[model samples]
Target chain A: MSVVSLRGVTKRYGDTRAVDDVSFDLHENRIHGLLGRNGAGKSTAMRMLTGQEVPTSGQVRVFGENPYENADVLSRVCFIKESQRYPDIFVARHALEAAAMVFPNWDQDFADRLVEEFRLPLKSRVRKLSRGQLSSVGVIIGLAARAPVTLFDEPYLGLDAVARQAFYDHLIADYAEHPRTIVLSTHLIDEVADIIEHVTVIDRGRIVMDDSSENLRSQAVTVSGPTKAVEQFSDGHEVLHREDLGGFTRVLVSGVPTGRDTASLQVEPVSLQQLVVRTTQFHDAALAGSGNGNGKGNGKGAWS
Target chain B: MDDARPLFQQIAEQIEDSIIDGSLPEESRAPSTNELAAFHRINPATAANGINQLVADGLLYKKRGVGMFVPAGAREKLVERRQEAFGRSYIAPLLAEARRLEMDAEDVKKMIDAWRDDQ
Candidate 1:
């Protein structure tokens, strides 16, 4: 079932089009990844989904109905941001209490367990919490809300390696018990790539790629061989990315290699992060080569 | 949870999942390192390391001539092992944290009830 859907949605900021005519369906009880480079309109798209930002055009639906100012839908959705802000006087317990009251399906026991697991200081005010602790607080609330649809926007800013691993473990363990729609938007693509079932990649205010994580990983492979053989094999194939390493050429192609008589060829599946970075970079180069397309080339060069 | 354990330990649970789901039936040949590596986009060495860990634990055995196969009675053993580890790994800390938070047994039950009511 589609828990969230966007059809021809566009969000504009004065002269800037933050999100342009984007459309996708997020299914229920699956973890989805929303990925993009900075300023790529990922955040804008997420905001529109949560009704935090009004769409300039087209439709946005959550749970099969328009979510704009709809308390019933909004109440069942929890958006955990990178930097969660609370009132200066609000203590950790106060926030937890407020969450318990606000979320109709709040799991206080789970919340309290998470508080202890994260080692949250209940008496400490929100402003005094460290960046890692703040992220933890947001994660605790999002998980404890038990909302049908939960969106986490870059919730691991200052978390150390240990803390981040803890977050992943707890998320998987809890998710096994209670399946829900989890949309994780993060730049640490490699970290959550394994847990996500599907992914949507946005670049330059448009949806460049959206597919199952399994297919995305499997559909592309990097083949490295003699430059001549590589070029010959790559002919008529959709090359998502390519790299020249000394005398050898490595090309990431979208599709399995078959019927090749070349003896000196090696092919391997590309990592999810590698695939996304290479794909977005490839698109950028194509756009730049066209010269008239979305022409805001920074010239620092794309993903050297 | 320490970083010392290989990152694939976190993913090895998936192989266990295959066993539970009958994807890799009892005594059936397990996936090869290259297959797993390609399927997961992981380093072949890391994939082998995960398989080796399971091999060391006796959940899987090598046939030498034919690759690896799930050990007989592996599923039952895994269940027993997981149930045993669940006590110290999950329940103990949970109860300790609850007691430390001043939540008595009755309070814990009440909290569960309130959560049910809210849902």
Candidate 2:
């Protein structure tokens, strides 16, 4: 069942619609990847969902009830972002203590273990910590909070590759034992491609793609061969991207028929990152072709 | 881990490879979904889906409160099925590449003989 649902949600700031008529569901005990480029309104949508920012129009529902100013709903939700702020005098330990008090499911032992694993300095002031150390503080709180509905928005801002891998390992290990609804919003799509069960791609305040990761994995393929043969094979499919080099042509096409004969063409699978990029570009091109001019104008150059 | 197919299918194939290679013998307990997920660093739901596919195919069976187990003849059955698919999976590509190089079946047969002598 869907634990959280947004219906026609629109968050506007001044003249800009940060999140435009967005509607999607977060199912129970599943990991959802919210992905998009910078300035694509991913943060705005996340803020509205966490009740930090209310939508100008439409509804934001968590656990079937409005999350705005609802302590009961808020307690069950944990929003961790890269820009999380603490008091000037607060130390790392104090932050953990504060989180332990706020979250009913907090585990002090888990938090302590994470503190050691990340090599966090508990006595140091929160502002004095290094960038990676600061990110680890948020990561520890987010993990040990164990909220039923946890949302992580770009939680690995300054973390090194090793630290990020450690975080993913810990997350998978802990989540296997304690399942909960998780929304991970990040630009590192390939890193979490296997970890996430569902994917939602947002672009310019609109959702361009939303589906289970498994379904999206097989949705597109890249066919490269002689221009005529490649074009003929991808004739009926939705071409998301195309590149030409002399007589050779390559196209990324979606909705390809399974088991189609491709004896002359080189067929390869499209990675999740490539799929998201191509889908966004395809959406942008469609908008620009319609004379809307609302897109970022990057789409018009992709066709060449 | 391959990008060419769904992750769950890859997980299932990994388990199948273990079973076929005698590492995971028939009648032995199979890895739990959590074990697979933690080992592969993938979502538990995806690992569970992989296990469910094997169960649906009758290669693995549940012991009800115990855990999943490879059936008695799972290895043999898997080997037979893989052999059936060898033509499409391996030989077809081999022939396709040979055709591209302007080589006939007789040439491929001679090349295979030469490769065997080298081995």
Candidate 3:
């Protein structure tokens, strides 16, 4: 059964529809990657899921109940975003302490360990911390909260490679001991490619793709060879991206290679990040061609 | 191993290599998926998938809630599978390269003898 479900969930701000008619389910004990380009509505969707924002015209359910202002359901969910705000007087440890007060399953020892790993200052005011330090605070809480459902929206804003790796390590370790639903919204698809079992790619306030990572990994492949062979193979499938170099052509297409003879073309699997970028680009073009595309242009680049 | 192959498949192959090489002997506890994930910096779920595939292949078995372990005869089974794969993965390419170099089977046999002696 789904622990969280969104049906036609739409959130609007003035004339802009940040999340438009989006719907998906976060299953129990599953790690789902909520992926998309900047301003592609990933954050909005997450906020909606965490009940920070209400859907304008659809249903959003958490534990069979609305999450917005629903303390019973909200208590079981943790939403950690990069831009998380703390009180003016609050320090790094203070934030964790406050979260511990609310979360029933908070593990103080785990929090303390994570605090050391992330090199977070215990007594430093939240606002005085470095960018990476601020990110660490959020990550520390998200992991230590042990919420039944946790949503992390680009929570590793300024963390270094080592710090990011430490987060992934701690996550996998803690998760093994205690199974829970984890939805990580990130642009670093390749980094987390092996981590996510399920993937959901959103673009321009719409869900472009959703499937098991295994299925997605096998379905899309980049084929390169003689121009004619590549074109012939790509003709019927949905081509995500294509590049040409003189007589050689490479096309990224979504479909299984089925034939008695496919020896002429060299096919390779597309990385999750590549697939998402290409797919969102294709979605972008389609939206542009349709002339009334709900382009958020929220300025969140894939890398950022 | 090809990096293009799925991450879980690569992980499974690594564990299989360990088993076939006698490092992970029969009846010994294999590392948990989370342990492998942390060590390799991959997702624990993907590591779990790879281990689960081994379980399905009969090379590994679960000790209830204890952990996954190599079942008896797993090494022999893997050796049999590897030998079956040898002809296609190694021999075929070797023969093709020999043919391109204009070396007959007898000539290749002599070369193998020379290589063995030098080694």
Candidate 4:
């Protein structure tokens, strides 16, 4: 079941269309990676879903209700962003205490436990905390809130590697006990690739790819060897990318070959990060080509 | 450790690895899917899929409301399967790589002899 969904959602900031005609479901009880490059409309799309931003044209649904100004939906949804601000006078506990009041399922004990683990100084004013510490405050609230629909938009900005791992560990562990719909946005694609069950890749305000991570993981592969052999192996496959180095040819294919007759070619699976990069690169090339210069290689160059 | 196989398959193999190595004894409780997921930094569903595959293979059995466990005689059955699969998994790949490097039968024989002597 879909706990949250967007239908042809378009969020335009005056002349700039941040998100355009995007549609996908945030399936219930699964971790989703809302991934893309900077300024790729990820944050804008997230804002609309969380009721923080109104779409210029389209529908945003949370629990079968419009999320905008709907307390019923907003109470169950928690949107944590990296640049989240707290008043200068508010201390670390003040912020978390405020969150506890909002999320009905909030656990103060868990909040307190996470604060200690994250090494956040409870006494420090929110405005005076270091970047990493500031990030911890948001992570603590997001995790402890136990909201049914939680969206983390690059939730960790200045957090160190250790803290990030801690967050991930707690997230999966906590999620197992209490299943919910989670949409996490991040540029560190490889780290969350395995943790996320589904992936929705947005590029230039468009839903370019939305599918189970398993499909992406199992289908995408890199076959490299002698030019003819690689080409023969990758024939009739959706080749996402190809490269030439002297006599060798390497292609990223979206199909696995039948009967491991992979004698000459080395078949390697493409990592999630590689898949996302190649896809965005392909999408960009098609757009730029079609948007300029006779549109000669627009479609042909995209999948070549 | 770095293999191109899917995450769930790799996870299933890792559990099988422990079983084959005598680390996870017979009839012992298998780690919960959540435990494995957190440890590997993977989705719990993937870990569950891996465990479920093992359960389907009779290498593991589910106990009601408790957890998955290695069945009695699971180790022996797993060992037999591993032994049968060794040639395809290890020797075939070894020979393929050797052939790629243009190694003749004599060169392979020498390398095997040296490897056995070292062992």
TM-score top scorer: 2
True-structure RMSD for candidate 1? 18.9
> Candidate 2's residue-wise lDDT over A1-304, tens digit each?
9999989999887777778999999999999999987777889988887889899999999999998998999999999988999999999899999999999999889998999999999999999999999999989998999999999989998899999998999999888988999999998888999999999998878999999999998899999999998988998888999999999999999977566668788999888988998898888878777875444556744311
Task: Give the distance in Å from residue B94's predicted Cα in candidate 2 to where it truly belongs.
Answer: 2.4
Q: For model 3, what is the alpha-carbon lDDT of residue A159?
A: 95
TM-score of chain A of each: 0.95, 0.96, 0.96, 0.94
lDDT of 2 by residue, B1-119 (tens): 85688888899999999999999999999999999998998999999999999999999999999999999999999999999999999998899899999998899999999999999
DockQ-based CAPRI category assigned to the predicted complex of candidate 1: incorrect
Where does model 2 exceed 4 Å of error? A258-261, A291-297, A300-304
Residue A256 accuracy (lDDT) in model 1: 66
All candidates in order of lDDT, best leading: 2, 4, 3, 1
Please report the candidate that would top lDDT against the real structure: 2
For candidate 4, the clash count comes to 0
Candidate 3 clashing pairs, residues 3+ apart or interchain:
A38-A300
Clashes of 1: 0
After superposition, the stretches of candidate 3 with alpha carbons farther than 4 Å from their true spots are A260-264, A295-304, B93-118
- Binned by DockQ into CAPRI classes (incorrect, acceptable, medium, high), candidate 2 is high
Better of 2 and 4 by DockQ: 2
Off by over 4 Å in 1: A292-304, B1-119
